[model samples]
Target: MNNINTRNLDLNLLVVFVTLWETQNVTRASERLALSQSAVSHALRRLRDRLSDELFVNGRGGLLPTPRAIELIGPVREALAQLDGALKGAAPFAPQYEQRKFRIAAGDIIEFLILPRLVAQIAHEAPNVIVEVLPYPQRNDISSLLENGEIDLIIGAPGPTSASLRQTPIISVPLLTLIWQKEGLTQERLPLNLYLERPHVMIEMHQRGENVIDDALRAQGLARRSGVLVQNFMAMPVIAEQTGYICNLPAQIAHVFAQTFNLSCHTPPLDFPAPELHAYWHNRFDTDQGLAWLLQKIRQSASGP
Candidate 1:
């Protein structure tokens, strides 16, 4: 194959090419690009002539990309993304000024525990920026979401690491025992056997059968009878209040709920380690000025001065 000429190649034509490739129809691409259908057709012809290849051919229902077109897609998209980043100036996350929406994937617990504070901070600082938080059903796929630009960030427990993802530790706090009224439980700390004997409320958000508490219990050959299963930490207080069920949750969140719902919190007797929470993102956005600024602000809020 002849190398395409670097000189006299219009960059704007590549934008049209990408739009047409994605939409696979001149009429649709024209509508999406706010250009006439004839204009889009003319641009495709020009691109074909420039590259000496019929990039797409009409198929059964839609335009199909030719082999050469398939080969060009990755490089073209990457080049355009680089060009866009350069032209857009420094910050990628300037929600105060930029009109881009940031998508975040996190568990319900993290949303309940941390988002209110983060949103308050964003409202005061980056009022124009919009945030969409989506639930991550499988924590293992979080790295894939960041790599594919599906999510800008993931806030959750310390997840398995990948080469493409970078992590920033926010805070690590011990787990506390959450119970309803302290009617029967007199001691501030209950023994491991007693804790396991009591009926407990479990929050199984990500994995169905596996839980951090279960793993800890298995280590000591002890198991707690799950009286109820709830999905979110926010529901734990309400459920425990009604059923007198005990729950183990992050100390920060447990304390917050305890104060609000007038629940009792105590140190668990088991030797369970504390959960470590971290924020992970694609390394590609590490140097982005706007994302960097937002991350710093989040860290400040999470860690305090």
Candidate 2:
């Protein structure tokens, strides 16, 4: 990095390099930048010369970023965003009229718990604002997604692990076992033996790792039988309603299912962890007025009526 001359480099060329990396096609990148194809090509040439590397290579799909360009992308985008925000000056953010979209990454359960309230609040306060809730990427990829501006925030379990990321706990949700009430098991607590014997509907959120309650049971030399496995929490209610399968889920979600479906929530006989649902974002947005305001709204929504 020290080999490159900062003083001699054209920042606009960096913008072109970043745009080309994003679009992967010279014509499309030129269109995005409102520049001629020849001009975009010239910018790429100057960027390559300045960096002493082939920043991109033409691939079958489009243009593929070289390893060096991939390394530079996060920092380059952050720099551009910071500069753009700074140029807006000391003017306060006016979400009521500031038309913009925010992209948030979250799991199915968190989406259920938060979005309806958040959207309602935004509609009343910032009618023009759009909220894009994307499925949470794998834990390892979250920080880069936030840094590169691919996602504005992440709401789920703690996985960022990086010191640079920021997380605030929204709520601590207790774990509960959900079973169809038609089974006539009106017990307030599920006995450990019955829990082990019942067929389970597993909610597989992570690519790998034991379910939280399963991990706890395993620690106590116990295990549950999984008759069905599904990716999202939304699948549990339908299957649990249709079959005799039991599922362990967050207490709040279980309560909602209990009210709507033929299901009942029971305390797990074994000790389980009460995991805190947290809102995560890149530290870069810590002071961004819009993001800060949105974060506050998320906290309020999580607290509930």
lDDT of 1 by residue, 75-95 (tens): 999999998998877654545
RMSD of 1: 14.5
Native-to-model Cα distance after best TM-score fit, residue 121 in candidate 1, in Å: 1.6
Residue 203 lDDT in candidate 1: 83
Summing lDDT over every window of 10 consecutive residues in candidate 2, give the lowest-scoring window. Answer: 203-212
Q: Which candidate number has the best lDDT? A: 2
Give model 2's clash tally. 0
Model 2: per-residue Cα lDDT at residue 20? 95
